[model samples]
Target chain A: MNYRDPQLCELLAGQYVLGTLSARARRRFEGLLPGRPDLRRQVAAWEHRLPEVLGQAPAEEPPAAVWNSLNRRLFAEAATTPASAPRGLFERLGFWRGWAFTSSLLASVFALALLLGRETEIPGYVTTLASMKTRTPMWVVSASPEMDRLYVRALLPMDVPHENGCLLWIKPEGSDQYYLLGSIPEHDGADKMLKIDRKMRPMLKGELYVTVEPVAKGMPEKPAVAPSFAGNWVPIKI
Target chain B: MSSTPEVLGDLLARCALADRAAFEKLYRLSSPQLFGIVLRIVRDRDIAADVLQETYVKIWHRAGDFRADLATPITWMGSIARNQAIDTLRRAEHRITQADDVDEMYDLADDSEGPQDAAARERDAAALHRCLEELQGAQRTAVRLAWFRGMTHEELAEHLDTPLGTVKSWLRRGLLRLKTCLEGA
Candidate 1:
């Protein structure tokens, strides 16, 4: 559709403000509005002129819990996340400033990739997750974008509860949502080549976390509780 | 918490600066109408509350993007709420009410006019109301249901007992005419 056509712009904007656009269409239009001043103006004009329509709805105060939870979600969440072993992967080890340590971590990741039969140049993203308390690498996680594969190597024994297992989470850059990669069962071999959802392959560069969640039944669609572990992928130019 | 656009816009400005107090004030002032619209559309209070939460989260994050010149505070916020509800309704396997037998449900929908309606009426909405009056009966009702109930094209078609194409043309025509009428007024 030619958005430049004044008539089409007006119609789309009006339908948008009138609350008739489909969810998909509305998102597409909204996605377009940032670049289209004419469309934005039309949407604004409809909103400005149609206050009566907006006002015709009956007003009901939302439950107080709504505000309470909203407050917690936006404000209090960071302070409350219990980190039994909470740590950022690089900062705690001081790898950020110590070039030798960071380089060795990179080398470890490459070695693991080689052991997994992946091309050395094709390890798209890799990270070493160390236990916050132990200050020793616990897991070396890597993703091969070319094969859409995720591999986890247990450098140290994971001491999760018998009933619970490590739940891997992929958080794309700038997103609050955590996409479940897969579960790492208790008996997951020392070097387990895990199958991640192919959709998450491209999004693997942002962050990777392994939270302790129940995996007895299967991987729950979402983590049952707040994530305990928070860490990012080791960015690899290769 | 009652406020004019200037006050609300100022609150929004402060919210943009990451002031929780300003965000709370904005929510307290604007949430009644926003919640009201969301509840009426999504119909389930639980879902409505969830949708409202998402709406305010977006508003808080995007408060800096508000252009005071282009839109009023409540309407701008209300549009976000409405859009979120409609989007939720589409994704959720919500129910059949918005489909086949929609007219009775549309008429019986919880909200038609309330304090906000009267308050908005006394404000400068007189010209817009007059403009709305000029659309044909079907167009006016379709527009009203779409606004207040968040009715979709299929819902409006079923409710109006008209063909889908006819309903779409009617709504589009109604909006075009209203655009012309409102711009003139």
Candidate 2:
């Protein structure tokens, strides 16, 4: 393949940008891009030109939760693989799998609770811890007295600064385990109701710990920030 | 033109450095565009969000690879967004063909303006949008196939069942027209 032919390059570039290029052809082009500047130029030209055609696409705001989850994943990656970046679905799955073990544990609890008469208390006044300096809240922490459910609300006000999405966690005393409640919305002043089974709910000792992890759309997870909010369980005085 | 491309590009660059600020900025600037494009292709908000996150992860790692020569920041970002979306569509077993799909794909642009961009994009999008309008049907098809589907000539040929020469010609003429149109705009 003559990588230098302008017309051939443009033709190939157009197709590549259009995504009509075969998988094999794309690999070949990617192989050429690093070694051949001219090829890269052609590809770039197509990229610059084609975006207008895509203009008719609707402008949509992704729920902030996506960004929040992405940050958690990226930060988590930074903690474990700071030097070597995680890539592709398998790597992502590995990240999710590590968290899944905890989810599975929750699932097991759900099964047990359903079978027995064990009742779980819903958390009240779920609040995210604010940043020490800016006092900006970073995660969404919620409480639900309803067993098997989490009532989530973005604690940060509409104007308060924070990431778009967040990671939910519950730390019950004596368990040494952190319960993952997936991702939730952050920016908009809307409350999200999350369902938690026996496996997902932290069997709290009245006082429970909650944390949020920040995420973005493209990057890996950042570090899990320290617990932003804490609640105390007041024993019922008989 | 909206400020999306440049903002996204800037954020992408910052994200490469693991800058959360950049990541947040990028999300604010481009998530709507990414979400819009992906939602159009996938038609599911939840799945679109998943794709959006994955796309950003790719962007974080690959943002450094972005070249001023290959595409404008938005185009480059758009390419990533579109490709990830189509990949999800394929993975979900949506068997829609290319020709029909392009028609649906191009409808994502908003003629009704909302956000604003830098003066350069204003000039660039005007020119690019016009050039896109001037393209012949075949030329447009070739461009869309390459850009949106990430298809190569051979796959395009196979999918369209057209002669290789015809495909090449359409793509060439289409690109030239686009260049001229963009430059003039």
Candidate 3:
């Protein structure tokens, strides 16, 4: 198709923005959008012109959860930790390795408790981590009630290089601060347990986020890259 | 709608810097109108909420790419919401099976105010309403149905009880007139 033809582009762009183009045609137009600035301009023109139609719709307030969710996602880290600090205990490999061994043992006990339906005293919380973009669950993150330890199990294999690893972050409730909990091993499908610092335990009641960063340099105080997966650490009900 | 172009542009610039407060301000200033637009197209409250969420996420990430010279922030964001709604509608199994279904597709622009009052409120909106009024009645209906219903040419022809070729002609002529009128405005 002569997508560059001004007449055709205008026609298609109008229909595209108006939502009248067929699904197949719409995809074709969108595929053309990235490379063609003129096509994009045409689409924008149509968009600017159409809102009078939209302005006619009666406005309704969105439910409060929308703001709460957005607030939790964007500001949780700013409330607890200075954005540039690197003092988190999770940045140390030796501490992480020791905790990994202990966390595995704890996870086994926790699993056994679940299987036997027996009561346990380790107040714990668990959440399924999912991609922000796709909303597909990728991992499960669990924390002991005392908020001193975390267990992360991979539900899907991730692609992390030997020199690179995944880091977990916690954002305490009612605060904008984000704390670096520590790094997970580079193994794609392996489960790793982490020890949360005693000082940071009180801040673990908020949300959990995981990001892939260079392990050789140590985990940064803040995620240098976008989080790979994230979820809230809801308390476990007996 | 109370936010001026300058306010929205400033908020968008701050959002590009990962300013959480600015993002919240932008959402509060713009979301009700954008949500209304999405609800109009998707016609499902839950789906509209999801689409609105995704739309804001995109707005947050793409804030740096926004150019004030190209379009107003609301226009750019509204386009994102509308396109997402159209995609969601297309993916679902529900399809308009009868001509009567098209009538329920959109609520007409509230006509409580006369044209003069509307024009005085917002120049751009007034200009658009005026230009749209210039088209022949059939052309206007065809264009509105095509837009508000997201109908294909065949679907539009079926809904309007007109020949496929005639519907195409009306839409083509209507769009050309709209482009000329909007640009001239």
DockQ of candidate 1, scored on C-alphas against the true complex (2 decimals): 0.25
- Clash pairs, candidate 1, are none
For candidate 1, the TM-score of chain A alone versus the native chain A is: 0.51
State the lDDT of candidate 3 residue by residue for B31-129, as single tens digits: 887787777666778777877887887677566557677787777777877777777777883454545443344445433432123454466667767
Q: In candidate 2, what are the lDDT values of residues B61-165, reduced to their tens digit? A: 665456544466666777788778777766675534545567665664565553334465566665566677798887776676555444556656777889988
Q: Which sections of candidate 2 miss by over 4 Å?
A: A53-56, A83-238, B1-10, B67-72, B97-108, B112-130, B141-169, B180-185
TM-score of each: 0.57, 0.53, 0.55
TM-score of chain A of each: 0.51, 0.34, 0.52
In terms of lDDT, model 3 sits at 0.68
Q: Candidate 1 residues A1-238, lDDT tens each?
A: 7778888888999889888888778767877776677788889988866655334456789999999999989887535752122123233222232344366577777677578665445577777654322234556777775637777776556678778888878767667678888775434337677766667667766655567867788778777865544445645675
Ordered list by TM-score, greatest first: 1, 3, 2
Candidate number with greatest DockQ: 2
On residues A157-181, what C-alpha lDDT tens digit does candidate 3 reach at each position?
A: 7777677777878777667666898
RMSD (CA, angstroms), candidate 2: 15.3
Q: Rank the candidates by DockQ, best first.
A: 2, 1, 3
**Clashes per candidate (backbone, < 3 Å):** 0, 56, 10
Error of 3 at B77 (Å): 0.4
lDDT by residue (B63-167, candidate 1, tens digit) is 656777788788788888988888888789473463433345444444344323356556646676678779898887787778766778987888778999999
**Residue B48 CA error for candidate 3 (Å)?**
1.4
